[model samples]
Target chain A: MSDLPENLKYAKTHEWAKLESDNVVRVGITEFAQAELGDLVFIELPKVGRVVKADEQCAVVESVKTASDLFSPVSGEIVSVNEELSDAPEQVNDDAYDAWLFCVKADNPAELDTLLDASAYGQLIAE
Target chain B: MASYSTVSLPTVTTIHKTALYELHIELGAKMVPFADYQMPLQYSKGIIHEHLHCRNQASLFDISHMGQCSLKGSSAAIGLEKLTPAIISRLGSGRQQYTVLTNSDGGIIDDIVVTRLGQELTIVVNAACKEKDFKHLRKQLSNDCQLQELSEHALLALQGPSSSHVLQQVAPEACRLQFMQACRTEIDDIPCMISRSGYTGEDGFEISLPNRFAEKMARILLNFPEVEPAGLGARDTLRLEAGLSLYGHELDEKTTPIEAGLSWLIKNTHQSYPGAGTLLNQMQNGTEIQRVGLLVEAKMPVRENAPVFDNEDKLVGRVTSGSFSPSLGRPIALALIDTEAAVIGATLFTRVRNNLIKLTVCDLPFVPHRYHRS
Candidate 1:
């Protein structure tokens, strides 16, 4: 079973969003997503302050075998991104929840209601 | 599931199913379609871990889909030697050699592993090109000889530093065989053919057994603490690190063994063999492009089909195979380039998407070979 925390919301694409005070929701891929990708070698994330729509591709993670896109769960303006991942993307595989991709100031916080909670996400992936 | 903005997702094709499909799924492996089989590309342990396991310990691989056969007759040696450049007649009993099935014009048809087993010769060819290879061999050899395809057999490769030790527990005599030698042995009262050869450049064995006994043999081997089941993804990367060539990438119909840097397999004494004239001529006047190894300076890997450029940014060739070599902890590749451009330490550039990654021509077998020759 994947280590999905109860504090965050998840997208069906396997990304997690954690609310970080006020309207900011920090985003990152789930552990299951990184494990499926194997060893990550390169990552291309969107620039800071870039406005991204919900379900839009916000980043790209490439492993030795294949490349995958990271989608945003809610419409938001990017505030901060993990610059350390530029050199060591394997950290995402090590701790997906901790290796947050970017912090976005969500345009609509109510969009979180549509996302699955930790228990619901667990039930969804269990199938 | 919450609805999201729609985007064109990459088409996920139907994965081709393999004979051991259920077994892989049970092991929690990541299955992918490769060549026509729904093979296990990696297990839950991942490719790098599986690759390192095969180097340090033993790893079992399902290679049953590869073609295997036996050629028998009084004129089998002479008849087969006419098609390949290897000196098969001179190979001693229980000896194995790597040979190329060649075209009349000296191009490579396929690379095969040929083993001499007294009155008959056992051969293993690539899975994808077996049909074409069998048809060509049938046409080239005389009717006095017989060719029997053993498609019903399951082939498994047990490779690593500890392979011999693990195999000795079952077949004690197998521990005595030297590299490139083969013998018929009984493992736990089951009949099988064991060859002291493998693609990973480790001390290992390729065991051929009846289909009915394959699952059992696999279970028996996996019982050993040192052995684990690896998938095709690790197999490919391990072979690449060992400087071994794959059929579609390095060995192909348009390339010759000489051009591929496998000229040593062409014996000097085989003067009357097929393509000997063309090979000897190429030997006298070296080939235009020679296969060479590359060491990428950056962490980003240069995958297959990436264009290679010279110092002046002139396109010289393309990468045939490339990967992040687990053993070396860096990116390595094999490329066939113009002879003048293949010099060691020559600065080259590999076009990786929009960025031009710098590379250097380095020696192959990025990891030192650990085969047990004694």
Candidate 2:
């Protein structure tokens, strides 16, 4: 029931990626991921311009009862981070699709095909 | 496949299962062993969702592992009065009050809920100490009254601000009842005892039904748009936010009701009860440590058993229960601190892991109670 756009790619860990201009990919958690971790109270975002590999922990979202790690979907150099989430992390829970966590310049654009497409990611979560 | 050498493993203790075990599994709950019961710690919707859901709407909780029993016959009230400090004889029908079971030396055995149901008195004890409570009750009470354990029944709690509305949709009669009142009713054709009482400090009800009909009743209740199945993890956080006491942490054999600040439950008119004299002595001379509420001034929570210190760095007491109160948007705790440091505005410190978190003694029930007293 999450808003999984067909044009986007997703990681098995639940992060979503949308390719932007200039080889930059905008990354954020899926709606399903935010719903699974309700009422987010705190978020620890990675510094901007930091290099991160695929599956690396890029952020932390602490809910009322538990804390969860936000993983990076592709190897990239962080170009810009969502500084707004530092003050109001619940914006992610309110609208996960629109609240981008960060933007990264991928080392290789071909890495996008290595991630699961919208339909495949939906099928994976259905299981 | 080659035969493998057998390794010895620790024997698993017999854990009590709830009536909604199948439903919990179907919802993908994370089961954990707690107090000899296989209880759900959290569900697939997760603890934060469940906790917030209970505060905003109604959440169904399976608390059937708690012990339920009835004391019957003519002399039941007088017999029970002899064991505990609560004035049971003064209680009328449909009245519920908190009381404690005390040992011979005036120490607490366990805290329990006592309800007067017509001629018989119904009691709910902690699950871990039910056996000990039963054995003590047997020895103290006269043979005129019979003690009957209702272990075959399952207890369900539907709690939140909207619980009354959700329950009223199915059973209209429940809407007329005030808080702490109990009545026999039918839900989806299953006869049950519904009490307008809960631990969440919200307007809610606790229903006791036959074990076989528990799942059906749960399904019927969950059918309400506002109701969701919550687990034990949220239950603990909610209770702590309400400033309610847990058995092993707040109440135990070494502590008395007076020290736990539960002297309100003990009636001075109850002349012949055990622990009355001891409580009177403590009231006059005062106890060493007193339980008080603390508001932590930090983001990280200070969990149980955290050492409490004064501004001068002297150890005063320890935290019994601590958690990030979902309703209050800050971490809070209940600690038993030195009587001198129990002032409402007294500054204190709780050592969480390696850091000394600043705390201040404050009023209880971090969130305002929403119980429908009327």
Candidate 3:
């Protein structure tokens, strides 16, 4: 089992969201998700200013084996995108927590409480 | 959420386990359902490492899921010639030839490797098409030929540049055999048949032995420092880089051998064979669409079924097989396209999602094959 960061909240879909400051939340895929997907060759990040709803498909991640859609955990407008992923997508595989995919200005900060905690997210992956 | 890929999923209820199933698990392999069998997609080291390890040193692959069988009779060679385009009778003893099983309509039923061993001929067919291939052979061949499935046998391939150096430790005589040659040998007092050929385009050996001894043999081979276990994931990338045609991807019931750029395998003689008329015609004239390799300029991979287009944005073909080439560190693919657009240096494009990626129609084999030929 992979380590779950206590400070971050996780979606059942495998994306992790961290409340940075104010209403802004940083998001990226969990470490367990990267292992399952294998070496990342390509990543399509959601553009800045793109308004995405919770549980809606916001980005795409592709490996050598297959491509997958990444869903947003919280409904918000995309404030910032990870442009570095365009050149080096393997960084996510190296450090999933450090390589955030996008930052969202959350519409409801209370949605973070609704997400799974560290222990809960660990249990979901264990099953 | 990640969508499940059907590529590695098992559709059937009855699943088969290979002889090295336990060994694979011991090595921390991530197993997936493939062709009704639980196969390792990669080991703990991952696909890229496994692939390069095979290229630089040596890697052991469990090919037990592939069907192994023998055709024995006085007219076995002649009987096999009727199904494939290769001149089976001309294949000398202790030698192997790559050929395809064709239907009457000039379409490929399965791609197989046939080894002539004295009076009997042994064939290795793809796992998914083995049952159907045996049925086809039983119905089409004459009564003189006898088909026997080697179900109790396990097939293992040791592939890489250092394969011979590693195998020479066990079977000395097996290393003396050149490429495409085969011989019955003994390793650790166990009877085994080894062929110096493989799908990875390396100097390797495919060892066939009884199922009871498979675990012991794999353990002995794995004990070597150069040999590490590779899985189906690395196997796919290696074969694609070698520019080999896969059964379902580059070939199928609807695709002919000639269109797949395998005209050299067909004998020049006008011998009677399945789909001989169309095959001979396509050989003499030309095929409308020819299979070629594509080098993707963009970083993203162009997957199978992606529509290919010409410079004018005209629909030309579809990508049959595409993957990230670990050797080249870029995306490579095989696409069947119009003969006019399928030149050595012609530019083509493929649509991936909303992006139209530029691709160049280059020669087959994004990476060179290092086969040890005498």
Candidate 4:
């Protein structure tokens, strides 16, 4: 079984989101995504105030093998980002869920209900 | 004498395998199709581990899939000179030169390693370009020149700081050879040609032997505690960090050796080859774009074909090859930029996906070459 934190929510694209408040949340990629990408050589994140649509490619994660897009799980305006990744992107490989890529002020907090729970995300990755 | 089988990617049914294919499978290598052959990309430890290990100690690589050919006879030297403008005629026996095969337009067809051994000239060409390279050699050379493709032989590279010490254990003569020099010798009774040259920046040897002894030789070398078998994944990163150009990525049919910053490869030959006219023109007027190494500022690696922009946001060039350097602990890249923007320390920007990233022109070989000079 893969590590899927039961307290958080996941997207099919492999991003994990944790609700910080009723209208705000923090987002990062899951361990599975980082492992699949291999040694994180580069990470491109959205700017703090950018509005991203759900499922839009708002960032990129590059590995030695290839580059993968980071899709937003919900519509939101970015509030903060992990600046540490600018120098050490491999932190995502160290602990993906803890190294939150960005924080967002959600436009619709209700959309969180549509995301996969830890159990559903676990089953999805298994496939 | 050909044994290479380049398989079509659509199906996995008929991929060619090297002599060490079974050994790689037993070691848990993840095999993938490369230049028509099923080669290992990585093993159980993955690419990063293999890459870092090669730098720290010594790593053994199976490069037998590369094409090997021999040109002999009294006219061999002149015949090969007609194909490339390198100093082959004056190239003394036992000397090896890194040269290029050019078309009539001065564009690079393929980058090759030519070594003068006894009366025959041994050539190592890229795996993907081997078939065409051999065909071109046969067609272009005069009848006096005999071209024999040595496809039945296997090539192995043992690279790193400890390579000399480990290899010297089996054959003491190997340690006496200098960088870019080759010598024919027997390693544990396996007849081989060992060259103290490699794609990796580290000091190493590339040994070629007949097919029957290849697997036996690899097993003997791997028996050493300091030598670990590395896959193609580590091979790519090591070469990129060393600033060596891949034939297809950093060279192509439309690009010249001049643009690739390989002017040194062209010797002053009075005789004209295929691209001599165009090469002379470029030498006089300078090239439109030049290849330069980049030190990517952030963690983002600028992958192949990513457009590069100057500080003014004008598109100046594109990255030919880019990757994070395990040795330098920073992202390093090779880009083909306008000649004006290729100055060292010049700043540039490139897009990795949708985000803009910063890069600066710097010296090649993110890691200094530690070749054994003596």
Q: Best candidate per TM-score, number?
A: 3
Listed for each candidate, the true contacts retained, as a fraction, are 0.44, 0.38, 0.69, 0.50
Q: Per-residue lDDT tens digits of candidate 1, residues B84-145?
A: 88888888888999999988678889999999988889889998888898998888889998
CA displacement after TM-score superposition, residue A61 of candidate 1 (Å):
2.0
Looking at candidate 2, what is the lDDT of residue A103?
88
Q: Give each model a TM-score.
A: 0.88, 0.77, 0.96, 0.87
Per-residue C-alpha lDDT of model 4 across residues B256-338, encoded as one tens digit per residue? 98899887777655447888888877877999999999998876677889899999999999999988788787778998999
- Which parts of model 3 have CA positions greater than 4 angstroms off? B1-12
* Superposed Cα RMSD, model 1: 5.6
Q: Clashing residue pairs, candidate 2?
A: none
* Worst ten in a row by lDDT for model 3 chain B: B1-10
lDDT of 3 by residue, A68-93 (tens): 89998889999999999988999998
TM-score of chain A of 2: 0.94
For each candidate, the DockQ is 0.50, 0.26, 0.76, 0.50
Question: Model 4 chain B — which ten-residue stretch has the worst lDDT?
Answer: B1-10
The parts of candidate 4 lying over 4 Å away from their true place are A1-10, A16-27, A48-51, A76-84, A95-127, B1-14, B353-356
Pull out the clashing pairs in model 3. Answer: none
Question: What is candidate 2's DockQ?
Answer: 0.26
By the DockQ metric, which is better: model 3 or model 4? 3
Task: Spell out the clash pairs found in candidate 1.
Answer: B16-B38
For model 4, how does the per-residue alpha-carbon lDDT over A48-115 read when each residue is reduced to its tens digit?
Answer: 89998888888888887888888888899988999999778879988888898988888998788899
| TM-score, candidate number 1 | 0.88
Task: Give lDDT tens digits, candidate 2, residues B207-271.
Answer: 98889999999999888889999998899888888888898988888888888888787676775
Better-scoring candidate (DockQ), 1 or 2:
1
Superposed Cα deviation of residue B215, candidate 3 (Å): 1.1
Per-residue CA lDDT of model 2 for A14-118, tens digit only, reads 888999998899999888888776667767677888999977887877766566888877788999989888767779988888899898898887788889998
| Shift in Å, residue B28, candidate 2 | 2.7
